[model samples]
Target: MEKYTGKSVLKGIAIGRIYWYRKQEYRVEKVETADSEAEKKRFADALETAKEQLSGLYEETLARVGEDHAMIFDIHKMLLEDGDYLDTVNGVLEEGFNAEYAVETAQNQFAELFASMEDEYMRARAADIRDVSKRVIRILAGIPEDGILADGPVIVAADDLTPSETVKMDKNKILAFVTAKGSSNSHTAILARSMNLPALVSTGISDWEAMDGKIGVVDGFGGEFLVEPEQELLDEMIHRKNQWVADLKALEQLKGKDNVTGDGRRIDVFANIGKVEDADGALEADAGGIGLFRSEFLYLGRDSFPTEEEQFISYKSVLEKMGDKKVVIRTLDIGADKKVDYFHLDEEDNPALGYRAIRICLDRPEIFMTQLRAIFRASAYGRVAIMFPMVVSVSEVKRIKEIVGQVKQDLSAEGHPMGEVELGIMVETPAAALISGDLAKEVDFFSIGTNDLTQYTLAVDRQNQKLEATCDTHHPAILELIRMTVENAHKEGIWAGICGELAADTDLTETFLSMGVDELSVSASSVLKVRKAVRDL
Candidate 1:
């Protein structure tokens, strides 16, 4: 038996035969084209075909995974039309290269540019560029897009998978997925989570090809992969897989049940979502409300900032869908891992702790006010609360409140309808947690963003896979910070909630409840599981 462990994207277990996923390879050789115009025309035709394919894929993915994941195809389509990318491809064609060669050149150059970026999220974009370029190149070479083919259900092992490739796989044939390379933030990982598949990434398996057709066990909960397991281990893993399946079936029974402790203490179990379409999933999961609606999706994958009307339409859609449920939307938390080129952000050596989140909003109040106006306008439709991210000081909260007050007065003067909105700040930094008492007095509520809280407290970069063991969210310092923030918020007649990855961790669900946390917001899929934990406590 061979044992390997990696990062788990979802918690489950799968016992199946391994299916090595080797993507179709295309060799684009440089060919001297007599007519550069002909090659350019061919490239244009291929671009059109690629866009058509992406459109169909977008619709298909939208129906399967909802609009949030489907938007990746939209981004891919936008890249095909990007001027700089077109210029690079056309430049290669102008040098008398064939259409396929031109696309191949552009792919290598653009992929390298993104790969050299400081941020890990930006680095992941290299895969997108490669995926798009491959599509165009394949069309030029008269090759159909690739899809995984398996005779039966099997665990898929790949070096890595692009979002397009991940989406195109036949889900029915997939029992689990194991990859040699991927981050938790990768789109492939996101798709795996949305599909509720047992997945492990960054396994660093150099000889995965040799393990093809071998009996493999993917223990996603423990982040382990067993290859050609002994009878004893195989039986144990099969039993665990059965139990995992049973637990999922059991969790369904907890749906629509109140998240109350044995002592009759009720806690709000909310869901964190990025797009308005995700509200449907939240409702299906029976989330009490939305604890963290990330507002950044409005600004990402676009050439320019979203208009006030556009933002308002999205916010209002989600709010109206949730009806009377409280929806806490976090303002544009752009920067760091999430980058928008049109924002004209300066390059930083370390963006995670650099000029990001609230800093940008305060520096550019015009942009911030535009978003605030939209949220306030949408509030008239349903319960809405706005939270600022990466806030570290009382002065920042005061400034945000001052700006919000101005927005409210401006809207009132303009005769615009608005609602009673609650204001809050994300207690993600040590400074914010340490001075929770002072910060609590300025906001109506506090939501602990444990992802950043743990990272900042431990001085470890969460993106660094090598330091994963060190960046523990369960550290005593992080727990103490949560406790402090909750106590301070209660002292000021406000409430505290957790709106991070840790919120869904059932092991810590009781700990958070014990800390008097008013809410726990995780992904929509985790709502019932956390609710069960709370009820069990």
Candidate 2:
């Protein structure tokens, strides 16, 4: 038996035969073209072809994984159209190089530039450029695009996978993914998490081809991959896999069940969504409501800020789909890691602690008011609530209330029909949690963003992989803060809920119940699992 340890992207167990993922390799020879103009035209034709392919992929991915994940293809299309990228390719072609060679040159130059970036997110975009370049080059070389093919379900092993490659494969045939090189921040990793697939990255498995068709066990919870395991180990893994499957089936049974503890304490279970289409998933998962509708998604992957009508249409669609279910839409929380070029935010040494979320909204009331007016306008369609992110003080909440009040009045004066909307703030910072007693009085409820709360309370950079060990979500300090926030919220006659990654942790479900947490909002897929945990407690 051979054992390899790596970082786990999602927690699950899979026992299957190994399938080595290999893409066709194209060697672009540096051939001087007699007709430079013709070569440039060929490159342009290939770029157009690549854009069309990406457009089709976008529609397919959108139907499969919804908008947030599908936006990756849109980004790829944008990169193809980017002026700098086009200029580099054209400059190479100007030197009388073949279209294929020019594309390879541009790919190398752009990939190197992105790989050298300081920000990890930008660095990951290097793979995206490489993917796009390869697609265009394949067209120039007249090679058919390749995708992973397996006879049956198998654990996919690869050096690394690009987002396009991951999405192109038949997900039903993929039992798990084991990559020798990848980051948790990679788009492929995010897609794996979204698909609820077991994935291991940075495994350093160079001889993956040799293990093709070999029985493999992926222990995502333990961050271990077993190859050609002994009978004893194989049996143990089989047992664990069976147990995992059983647990999932049991969770399915809890779908329509109330999120009530054994002692008869009932709590609301909701789902956090990024796009309007995600409301369907939440409802399918039996989520009582939408806890955190990340409104910033509307602002991303676009040229400029979303107009009032655009935001209103998006919000109204989600609200109408959700009907009377309370949909808590968070105001624009774009900053820090989530940056937009049009925002023109300055570079900061520590962006997590810099201008972000409510800070940006407060600093630019024009942007904040625009979103508020849209949310209020959508409120007429169905139940709606507005939540502010990164609020740290009662004064900030008060200012937000003033803006919200003015927005409501403006809409009323315009004779727009509106429904009652609840106002709340995300208690993410230590200052917000510690001052929850006062801050709670200013809002209708408190939604603790444990992801930021834990990071802020421990002074740990959550995005830094090196600090993963120190960024403990279940730390006593974090629990105490959650407890304090919930207590203060109840004291002020306002309910408190958790709407972070930690909220989905079944292990912490009982602890949150003990803290009197009124609600838990997790991913749509985790709703039933969390509900099962609550009921079991």
Candidate 3:
């Protein structure tokens, strides 16, 4: 029995046979072709065939995943039809290179270009190009496009799952996912989380092919994959899996129940969402509202900044889905860890403590106002609230409100009807928490971002694995800061809430309730569980 450890992004247990994934590989040889026109014709034929395949894949992916994710296949089809790709291949063909060699050269050149990009998402697109080119090459080489074929359910083992490849996969056949290379923030991990599939990423498993057809146990909770496990180990895992399923089934009963305490004290339980698709999960878990809609995801995978209409559409979708429920949208928190290329952010020695969040938005008012306009326009659809991140002083809040007022004026002049929107600021820094009383006077409510509050107060980088023990959100000092912030907000007649991971912490449920916290926003998956805890209180 061999066991391998990895980072587990999603928690679950899967016992299934291993199905090693390998892309169809073909070798190209440099050959002198007398008929250059014939070589060009062959290349064009292969490209057309690849385009057809991608069109079908796009439709399939749209049905499987949502349009946002399925757009990746559409992107691939565009790349194939690109004039650059065609001209490069045809140029190589005119240089006396065969069809296969020309295609290989063009693919390698474009793949290198994308791989060299600083943007991680753009860098990952190199794989998409290679995947598509491989299809064309296989057709040109007369090799069948052999995909991952398994007889029954299997745990897919791969180096990495591209956006194109992941969406094309059969969800029913894929019991779980184990990858040699991927991160919790990768597209594959995001897709896995959306599907509620067990996934173990960065497993560094190079011998996955050898484990084909062999029964393996994926212990997502333990972050390990057991290959050819002992009978006793398998039995224990099966029992644990059964228990987890039972717990999930039990949590289902908590859905649609009002998050009220035994003493009839009511508190709103909301979900922190990154994208519009998360609205479904929030509703499934019966969340009262969406507390934190991380607006950065809209800016992340794209080549340029999203337009006002684009942002408006996304915000409108989430607001419309939630209906009367509140949706607190955080304006572009782009800086520190979440960097964008077009923003051209300068290299800072310490980004967390340096310029980020409100700092960036404040400096770039054009960008900030565009986002504000979108949020205001979307407000017309449903209840929408705007929240600023990494705020420290009253001046920033005042300035933000000033800009929001200007945006409202601009929209109104354009004959756009505005909705009744509330403005809030995130108390993530110690400075913000200390002056919560003064800050509370300027906003509708307070949403304590405990993750940043803990990091900044403790002088610890939350992203650092080595200081994991030091970054304690449960520290008395941290709790006291939250207490002060919540107290200050209530004093000003503005409700306070916790939106960080600590909001869902059951151990602090009574503490938040005692502190007069009006709401707790956590992940969609934790809404029911947290609501259950709140009710039991």
Candidate 4:
């Protein structure tokens, strides 16, 4: 099939052209030299509405164009805090260029700094930040966001895509997405995958000015986007589309049906939930239960820790939602890239390697105990399995057990019911995976959090977009660890489940089944896909 090749030199903003590509459109603007007040007025009007729309994104994730991600916010912070970025952009704007032009110059001025960074994730993050700045400048200069691509199933083109824009998109109109920026690890990938549309990332098509409404086919699995598709290729994709739709319909029948294998092995299919919205997927998909309710959201998106009563209310809602089914809730798996501005952790010289998870819980017993008290208090409504993250040693497991004991004592003293809460820990780190047999003897069950396990074992940072190629779940080392984890856990008479991206790896589900993983806890979207995978296995 013929591909669009001439857009290689044009940027999304420069030359009034978007290097045609397949990617997510965080927002679109044609950056060019505008020399009139009428243009400036148009820019101001767009900025006002853009800010209004972006205001909805001030939550913990700092989602949307404004909130935490607003380029103006970054400049304001820099200007207020005393730095070079704000000064540079201001100086450039004073030189008579439009806001977009000034912002582009400022972005270009930082190119050397970003290029020199050894950390791929940090560098990629800089690119995303610069790209965001261009959009903000365009809005401030009266450049309208490119309208929802020229109709039909449009492949929205952009230099990069943010998570919020990706989530809020009209999924019905977006058949697939291709991005010149962002990587597989970006939440854009997660959201797009959730939308169940095929997408390809990092195609780096920054110059396709004519790509709007142009026919393109994205082979998501192959990470390939073919533009100006040939008739033969179109026919083949049409065939594949029909087959996929038919298969999806068949998979839908599995919803609400028990996941007892043909051999009569009943493996509970549970949803790994983060937000209240996740419950919608769980209930709608008819999950057997909510397996891993990430409690981070309760403490996140706000300025401070939630009160115990507040936490209890959230926990109780989750349990009640599942009705009679089991819901395993992980208590406050904090730290890593997800941060709450108000809940300040001293910027550890090495945040990822320093006080996080059990380390933080141990140091701040009040924080951990309060969360536990809430979970114990909420256990009355339904089955609640309390899981811990990054548990590397049996001693850490024992410490958590002690906290549970203390919380039970405190709640019991208050005449509150302490429902039986099953205890578990994520076996993700190499140490934890290796000692799963011993740890399983102490804990009731084991959850294989492959995301971190892969990182800790391989020493690859998943957040780094540039080196995302290194973050391979299919690597033999990760697969071996998973196999070992399953073996060691069941040997101690405890069940093991997977809760990482690999949990739903249809390519490896049979491999995991062969290794004896008792269950699989996946995102709601993967429930049906993994169901199909399990059947194939």
Candidate 5:
């Protein structure tokens, strides 16, 4: 084992690796199964079972998280539609192949595409697609995902990783992650960083072939690794590891501390959550409360609208998480995302500007009404902050708020548990940025989703590989947007927070701190680094 010491990004930093595997799963079935109805039937059954198992997981997540998570299964559904995967496999099998042979040939095709991809997001998608393929093979061969995570401690290294893999990771035993193919924005990269697990990815520098278990220290943030580490190196890693734990202890002390800078400037730190239960982390982190509780999660994973009771139960769970802390919940922000499978929105020419966010809420007032009614009903239980997303106009805000007012009145008339809920908007577009001051007047606060703000402003999809270099956060326009929003929010006596990837970046923490952000709603892992940066600044 080699100890590597270098600046590491803190993507998925959690309580030191909870799960470890001494040996990595690298088995590949090499038999060539000929194309036949029997083969297709076997493959279809495997896929169907995977679908059912995944659906169960999906439903469970919805029950715990909310409907917003259902779209992932909708994606799963696409893989099953018309036996799309089966047909693709059959096409390969028709070329005179066995299961192993078919897997190899298709894998080669995928490898070529992965090689040809220029965008990091697109390249990372290859891994997810590969995971899907591998699972299909596993099903056909009767292998299971059982006990995979329980297999003891080792740094899981691969060419790349997917969200499914990272999200499924047993935080209980897994220690760390390393990959040769991914960069920061990849789903796994982001998830690992959020989990507070040390990871190193995009290591085009490391040799995956020769480096099986020799041992290497991974610094996730900056993507550094050392191989065949000496004793001195091991000591340093142990020291840093200890320092990391110590730093966590220190941040916990700041739980109730105001996010104040050296000059007495106060920045609010809130947790971005999807459901009410998600507020637990925010409260535990000693955050002011929830910054953005995307209510869409309630509507997303289920087949239809959640009954008012279901909505009430879900909202109540979050109120309990905060207890006395404030929770800013966003009413269903749908249009732009594939949040509802029934809607099946067509691939838009310009999704950033398409029918999404607050627009969708206004268009479908009933949908928004259910959530607002739930929030008001839950308001008696805890401090609730109500916000809307994709608000580029005052008219949209006015309409949506009016509906909320209606819901509150209706709930009150019905003798429901009604309470005061502050209204807010997500400042995620150039139009919204330009008029944030106006929006500030209408809403209680502004929560910036920079991922979309930057993309909409620059007219560049950050996910597109060709624009990766151009999709920088430091662009003058983006900084100015933050500056203006902060100023506007303050002018209105309303707080402003950032909930995008930028909120989690340690390097930029000082810059945002300097700019006068009221809150930072970032991943869990980033709390320490951001806290450290804030403490220093």
Candidate 6:
């Protein structure tokens, strides 16, 4: 028996045969061609074919994953149409090169350009270029795309999966996925979470060829994979798998039940969502409300800022879906790790500590007001609360309230009806937690964002995997901050909640209940488990 361990992002057990998957490689030879015009024409035909295929794939992906993920394919299409990319290909063909050779050369040049960037996000775009290039070259060389043609369920093992390939995978035939390389934030991991597929990454597997057709068990919960396991181990794994499924069934029954502790303490179990589409999942999970509706997604991957009406429609849809349930919509938290080209933000050595979130919104009130006006308009439909991100001072809170007042006044002058909306501040910085008493008086409630707070308090970059062990949210310091924030909120006749990953941690559920936390907002999948934890406690 052989055992391997890796990082597990999705928790489940998958037992199946191992299937080694690899993308077909198109060998590019620098063959001289006498007919340059003919080669150019061939390249153009391939481009046309590639465009059509990409458009169809984009639509399919949109139907499967949603617009945010489908945007990657659209970006791929744009890259194919880039002038520089075309010029490079045409230039190579003009130099008496074959169409395949010209396309490959141009793709490598652009890929290297992106791969050399210091920013990790930009560097990852290199894979997109390579994925698109492979498609076009395959068409030029008459090669079929790689995919699973297995007869039965299997665990797909690969070096890595591109966004396109990941989205297009046949879930029915694939029991789970294992990769030799990838991070938790990679497209593969994102898709696995969305699809609820058991997956393992960075397994350091160099001998995948010998493992094909071998039966294996993937323990996603433990981040382990066992190949040709002993009978005793296999029996234990099968028993665990059955228990997991039974637990899921039990969790489904817990929905619609009160989130009450054993001591009769009641708490609100909310959901943290990104897009309007997430409202359905939140509702399915029986969330008490949406504690953090990340409004930044509306501002991302677009050419310009979203108009007031556009934002209103999006917010209203979610609000209307959860009538009478509070929906906390955070204002645009741009800059830092999240950025838009039109914002024209300057590069900073330490963006996390630099201008971001409330800082940017304050400097750009016009943009801030646009979002506030939309939230107010949407409030007319149902319960809507506006929350500000990365706030560290009472002065910033006062200024935000003043701007909101101005927006309401302007909307009233224009004869537009608006509803009453509650204002809240996210306690993410140590300064915010320390001054929670002062800040609590300015808002209706406080939502502790432990993700950022842990980073700021520990002086550890959460993005740095090496320091992940050091950035402990369970540290006594973080718990004290939470305890203090809740105390301050109650003292000021307000409520305190946690809307970070910590809120979903089952082990911490009892601690939060004991701390008198008013609400716990977590991911949709985690809602039932958290509720069960509260009930058990």
* TM-score attained by model 1: 0.73
- lDDT winner, 3 or 4: 3
Q: Per-residue lDDT of 12-71 in model 6, one digit per residue for the tens?
A: 998989998977645788999999999989999999999999999899999999999899
Error of 5 at 431 (Å): 0.4
Question: What does candidate 5's lDDT look like per residue over 230-305, in tens digits?
Answer: 7786677667777777867877776666566676766666667654444666666666667767676566633345
In candidate 2, where is summed lDDT lowest over 10 consecutive residues?
Answer: 185-194
Q: 194-299 in candidate 1: lDDT tens per residue?
A: 4567899989998977799999999998999999998987888889888888988888888878898898988999998877777998898889999999887687
Q: Lowest-lDDT window of 10 residues in candidate 1?
A: 185-194
lDDT of 3 by residue, 149-251 (tens): 8978899899987654665577678888899887654556766765567888888899876898899888889999999999998999999999988988899
| Maximum-TM-score candidate | 3
- Give lDDT per model, in order: 0.88, 0.86, 0.86, 0.67, 0.67, 0.86
Candidate 3 backbone clash number: 0
Error of 4 at 45 (Å): 15
What TM-score, computed on C-alpha atoms, does each candidate reach? 0.73, 0.71, 0.76, 0.65, 0.67, 0.72
* Positional deviation of residue 325's Cα in model 2 after best superposition, in angstroms: 1.8
RMSD of each: 7.6, 8.1, 6.7, 11.2, 10.6, 7.8
Better candidate by TM-score, 1 or 5:
1
Alpha-carbon runs more than 4 Å astray in model 2:
1-3, 14-36, 40-195, 201-217, 226-243, 301-304, 307-310
CA error at residue 358 for candidate 1, angstroms: 1.4
Q: Which candidate's lDDT is highest?
A: 1
- After superposition of all CA atoms, the RMSD between model 2 and the true structure is 8.1
- Pick the winner on TM-score between candidates 2 and 6: 6
